[model samples]
Target: MMPLNNSMLITGGAGFIGSYLINQLIVKGVNVICLDNFDEFYPRKSKENNIKSFIASPLFTLIEGDIRNKELLDDIFKKQTIGIVIHLAAKAGVRPSIINPQEYFDVNVNGTLNLLEVMKNHSVQNFIFASSSSIYGNNLKIPYSELDNVDFPISPYACSKKSGELLTHTYHTLYNMNVINLRFFTVYGPGQRPDLAIHKFVNNIYKNIPIEVYGDGSTSRDYTYIDDTVTGILAAIHYLEINTNVYETINLGNNYPVKLSDLIEIIEEITQKKFIEKKLPIQMGDVNITFADITKAKQLLNYHPKVSLKEGVINFKKWYEKKLV
Candidate 1:
């Protein structure tokens, strides 16, 4: 069983999911040390605002550093009494990864390696990795399972994540580290990163901007909400407390896929506005669909997602009006 401590290190703790995770941990009175470099994937200010609400908390520490920085991670490990590591830092977005494969590999793969090396040195064995459903690639299987073959990744981002999982597995095999890689589906909600489809569509429609419709708007994704994903992360940590001698991957998703066109319609209905649609060719690396088989999550962690797309879109629009407006 993994050791219990008050402190936990969460990389990329300033991003959308990290912010929510930090907040929840803070409420539970866990000492959370957030490490983020504030990469320009989006504006630094938005990411700063994500954790600004809880930045001043006594139990929270925000470290501005890159995952690629071994010295910085070493310093944090040496100084702080962190019991577990939640690795969430990555160069996100499949389209951007295509344009800059080197940067993606460097940050996603090399950075994860650097962190794992540091963790090995410190003997911090309990770990929770934030993986992506994009690793499933264009598989013919519906409702991709943890047992599915993920050898064929179309984008550098997916490849990077898959590499991270493999690295984690090796560590588990050699060091007996406890690890759980969570394959998060298309996560969307209030304060979501602007690059995601649901947020972009809602914002563009509100501003009367033309929305990009890729693949004739038939592409579908299993959109998991922020709360459900965070709950699963906490459960993984809890599971690690009692279980060890294991390396496992589970899908933390809603298990319900929504089409791009139907998502647009929901946004329009929520905002009471129509958007101009601009059709684009099916992107080369884009997958046909992403449907998660969350059966393992339900059985292992008792994970049950409670949000629907319509309700989630409404919630997103409400937060968008207040924050983005």
Candidate 2:
């Protein structure tokens, strides 16, 4: 990989995927500016600890702010000379989005617009938007494709993501900015967020708490490990180095869907502990399944995921034991 000439700004840089990506950049000695508000979606301490590994590095600059703050974004753009922007900040979670639709839109949709405007002003065209598979919603499609109709988002979070993707498209159309909307599958692994199933299940199982199962354990997710997802993102970032003035949306996933029940069993096998299953009703915004079709990612970005669910679960379990337990 060629050396980066200017700093890279990663929105929500302290969060799961962001933190991991930052560590990778740090190892490469790439100058990085991490912007995160430490949203209360989870404890701020968790996010703080995620960056503890490289926060003190001279290559990294941490900004404590929100993406909605356009003035702050502009100020950073004026100072940092950022060559690329990886927008990952958002009010995540589909179920919570059902209760507070406005917050989701405010942070995810409007906040994204703020960042785009700032980048437009700065003339920093390279952008990689961290989109979600939830945008697929309850589409009858088995393996969701980037070309599939993402117009039917069931939850506010999904809707906000779809809106962000559309807004990115519009910015690309008008400004001729380079944009790649990566529709990430269920990303899991070390430093996984607390609310995610892999994180929660491992914690609850370890503490002998009841592990909740929604939708009769039939609903499945295309779980892409954090390492794999971050690789695709880095590829997308480097892609702008060779490809320019284009708008593209690609799916980055394991291209494998594992049943909810099977996921729990995998966890049990890894931990050598049985879970007290508490079957719950299906979530309102939850989709029946999320299976990614990564053909476009492979063709364009040469994105290929290496981690399997079992291997990813074991890696996460090792992390859980070392960090939380």
Candidate 3:
């Protein structure tokens, strides 16, 4: 890989995926500037702990701010020579978005616009967006592809992500920016967000609490390990580095869909605990499935997911146990 000429700015850099991506970039001798507002969706300490190790590194710089603030974004661009912008900051979760649609649009859509405007003004052309598979909605397609028509989004969060993808493409076409929109599948592993199913289930089972199983446990997700997702992201960054006039939307996923019941069983076996399963009706905004077609990722970026669901769950278990100590 060619050496980066300037620092990479990752919005939401203190979050789960952002923190992991920053660690990898810094290890490769690349400078990183992480911007995060540390939203109240989860505990602030967890996000803080995510990037605690990187605080002292000369290659890492954390900016506590919101993406909606165009002034702050402009000031950041003016001060730092940023080579690439990985926009990962957004109002996440489908259910939460349904409860607060306006906030989702304001942050995910307008905030993205703010960043793009700043980047355009500063002439920073390289960009990568963290999109979501939920944009597929409840499409009948077994494996969601980039070519699939995603005109119908079921939830506000999904709509927000679809909006982000469109915004990136618009910027790419008008500004001649090199961009990639990566639709991430269900990502889980060590340092995973506490709100996610895997993390929540693991903790609940470990404590012998009843775990909620929405919709019959038949609903499935293409659970991609965090390492695999980050690998695909880095590959996308490299592709942007070596190519030009590029605008591609690709899926970074495990490609293997695991039903909710199977996921719980794996966690149960791994943690050596019995789970009290509380069945609940499928909540609104929750999709029936999320399976990714990574053929484009494989061909374009040579990306392949290496971690299996069981293995990833084991890794998370180890990390959670260590954290408890």
Candidate 4:
């Protein structure tokens, strides 16, 4: 396999997964242009700090812009010879989507459309989009697969993601673009969004605050580590390169579901602090479980998640403790 070209664009590169991917790409000697507007969902300083390690790197370029800004996108596309686009920008969160559905649609769906249009205009065909397993919304099946029926997405966020997949398919069909939509399961590790369960729990534990235990603690998630997820993303890039066929969607997850209670115990073990649990009713747009069927990813992209939840939590705790200090 030939080395990836120097020029690449990673939308939302300031966010959790995006920052990690950019760091890995830079280490591989690839020039990366990161586009992010620093949405208010998280602290701008957090996102800013996330990319500080790469700010001085000659291979890294930061563009403070939104994906919704069509003119900015057009300008970047026209100026840069971007070989691959990893679209990870989106208004991420399930319960938040319930309160602001339109906003989620605008960012996740419309913003995605703008990116696709600019890519098509610039002839940048190779693409990898950040899709979510939330698209499987309340799926009865234990482990959801790419072939599973995903027509019934409950939350607005899930609907928007599914729409993005459809839009990507349309672009691939019309322009013969090689697109891969990676339906990521619950991704967690250092730099996780504060809104996410693991991060919030870790923070609360350190602060001696009651950790909100939504639902009955029976809910489970296939928590994929950041490194493992990045590996899958890299594999998807290669997969598209090797098989320049139409569009494809694959699951990037550990395929192991751990109950909420189990996760809390792991966190407790790592932090050595007992969490004051505050039980709350299940919030809207929150699913009971998410178990990814990674068979497709394993076969197509040669993807396999390596990090276990216990190890992942320990790593996250270490990072959190350092950050607090």
Better of 2 and 4 by lDDT: 2
Write one digit per residue (lDDT tens) for candidate 1, span 8-39: 99999999999999999999889999999999
Over 1-325, each residue of candidate 2 has an lDDT whose tens digit, in order, gives: 2126989999999999999999999898899999999999999999989999998999999999999999999999998888889999999999999999999999999999999999999898888899999999998977898889888989999999999998999999998888989999989998898899999999999899997789789999999999999999988988887776768899998999999999988988989999999888997999999999999999998888999999999998888888864
Q: Report residue 13 deviation for candidate 2 (angstroms).
A: 0.3
Candidate 3, residues 251-323: lDDT per residue as tens digits? 9988999999899888888988899989999999999999999999999999989999998998999999999
The digit string of per-residue lDDT tens for model 4 on 1-325 reads 2236638899999999999999998898889999999999999999998999999998999999999999999999878888889999999998899899999999999999999999999888888999999999999987998999999998999999999999999998999888989999989999999999899999998898998898889999999999999999988877765665648899998999999999999889888889999999988888889999989889887787889999999999889989987
Q: Model 2, residue 26: displacement in angstroms?
A: 1.4
Off by over 4 Å in 2: 1-3
RMSD to the true structure for each prediction, in A, is 0.9, 1.5, 1.2, 1.4
Over all chains combined, what TM-score does candidate 3 have? 0.98
Provide the lDDT at 184 for model 1: 94
Best by lDDT: 3
lDDT of 4 at 76: 94
